[model samples]
Target: MLKIDDLIIDKEFEELLPVLTPEEFVRLEQSILKDGMLDPIKVWEEPGTGRNIIIDGHNRYRILKKNNISLNYWENYKFMYADELPTRDDVKRWMLEQQLGRRNLSEAEKYEMVQKFKSVFEQKAKKNQSLGGKGSTNLPKVDTRKEMAKATGVSEGTYRKMDVVMKSDNEDLKQKLREKKVSVDAAYKEVKSTDQKPITVKQQIDRLDKRINDIDKTIESLQVEKEEIIQRRTSIFYALDIKCPVKYRWDKKGYSNTFPCFWKCQIYIENEEYENIFGEYSVYYNEFPSDCDMEKIPETYRNDFRMIWKKAHDEIKALQDEVDKKSMENAKKQDEILKNAMKLIPTDEDKVILKQFYRVLANTYHPDNKKTGNAEMMKHLNDLKAVWGI
Candidate 1:
């Protein structure tokens, strides 16, 4: 009798983009149905809880359960003894690294993996600060894309644009990218174009040539709005609420018997129970008083936590700034295209036709522009072109 509580899947790991496509999943399910669990599921037993946690073979386990299939737990699965447990971070990081290092992931998948890995990295950094000194951060001031891309076996630029794609928040476009309907460069451009501000209907109904001329001014307004939005969106993460006077026990086992001690915290991220995602972090707190009650938490540790917490908040601000800056720059190109195309639009019925609007919009977004050329913009541009038969 297999109980549901016997194993819990790591959502932090499983929520990553699916490695298996629909066809691949079908094939895997078929193979498992016929072979009857040839591979053993690897699980870990939690200390003191006497509960088994699944570390791998999640897909196989799921398929079997869904089919109401049963097998001998001891005979069909592998378990780790309590003393040999890997931390939640360890299991997730190792599994992701293994997949990235072993598999030939698509550029899209690689980017998604990096984004997921980064959050895990950030969580680990936060944990480190909580355990050790107060003013420390794990990530150095370097090009993250370059380092992570090297790890993923891709170019830095490739990963950078892929990061842009993840930020785009359009799954249909992402699917198109996967299907080769869109290129990376075009996807980035599409993101920017979509950020274009909506104009008032009166201005939209104004003289065509005048409206084109007003785009530059409209773009400037959008730039200001974007800056305001970024400034207003500096976000903060929840800090660990301390249960005062945290107690601890120590040991003295040296030749001269010097006592070495460290610090630890039981924190829930975002004021929510985060145990399913991870466990509390522990680190060497060299500055701890031998007989200390962590009432105030040491200054060094506080400063470290502050640095990590503030960095996460600041990074969100910085990201918004970067996005707005890019949008402002791209808006300039799009407006200029409309400005030029307006000069060519004849003052006839076609001038105000909706299809003509699509046609002009398509030309501006086309990937082969001399001044605004972006091969990556082709898929989106083609969609606009199709509307007007251009």
Candidate 2:
């Protein structure tokens, strides 16, 4: 006696039910909340026992039970007979095919299910095929109720709602329902609306992607502006008195006892109310134009020698700031230059090696005393400082 809403599951059926883990159960619960059931449970009469037998959806039934849903809600639920439903082997095969299409299934689980379904179907199919070709063909085929439900493809449990709409007497509505299945609610509303059109899934996906692209562009623009601001702030160091004195190595051996400059002979003459103290010095080895000793200093500048030294120190410090700032800017600009050059340059490895060579040269000339092995090896260090940037 195959029937629809009349059969009920019994306690014995619970023992034979397939297991579901907590995570799976939660997902099902949420899906039910969002989209509802797409496929109705496949139920058949338990031969002579007179109870509703669940051919599929045991998980859904259990979930409904756990949540204490009223059984009355399922009163009008449409059911199919065993003759209308697919056989066990068919159901298993369909399950395997579904698992294969899904990315989330584990390899072991997929393999075991696939084997289980295929072996059973092959064995039965072979046995049936052995008998008279017609009889073998007539041998009970497996159940594909799940697959049929899937092919119908309503949002989830909405198939039940779809069944109601599909079974309506209006010919136009029925034709629309027969058309490739879309959202049940949407199909229903279309007939009710002045306009009878439905939206497609591709349109939905495209809309989502467009939104994501727009957000990415916005973030990129903001980031570029942020970097620009940081660069501008860094440029201020060029005008600031920020030089921290650094020592460097001039030679591998060490400094000579002599200062790298010449000396002067001084004369002091005094005659009532008039006095003069002056000296003349000679120039010594220098990389810069004005690096001479007191011999070249003019007599008009004799009184203010302290002031001259102070101003010279200030000027040197300012130039040092300019060199440091320019170096930082040049490096930033050169990184992009190097990256572009690498694309055209034939020998990438050689370029990398060359860069390393230059880095070593820079380090050798670095104006940090501790970076060198010994202070004595730094005698002419100050000479190099004048043209440090070059």
Question: Per-residue alpha-carbon lDDT of model 2 for 172-275, expressed as tens digits?
Answer: 65554445344457655654562344546875576577668657655654464355344443333222343322111112123332322222213322334433
Clashes of each: 10, 13
lDDT of 1 by residue, 1-390 (tens): 556446777543465435577788788799988887777777766443355767667787788778877756765577766455445446556657766776676677666666655645555555665655655555343454565776556687877777677555467888887666888889878866865866567645554655565465445544643543433331121133542222222222331222122223232222243211112333233222222333333442444443443443344345446666777889999999999988765554643575566666657766667776566676766665554344
lDDT of 2: 0.46
Model 1 clashing residue pairs (backbone): 134-300, 134-301, 134-303, 134-304, 135-303, 135-304, 185-376, 186-376, 186-377, 262-285
TM-score of each: 0.42, 0.26
Output the lDDT of residue 157, model 2: 52
Worst lDDT 10-window in candidate 2: 244-253
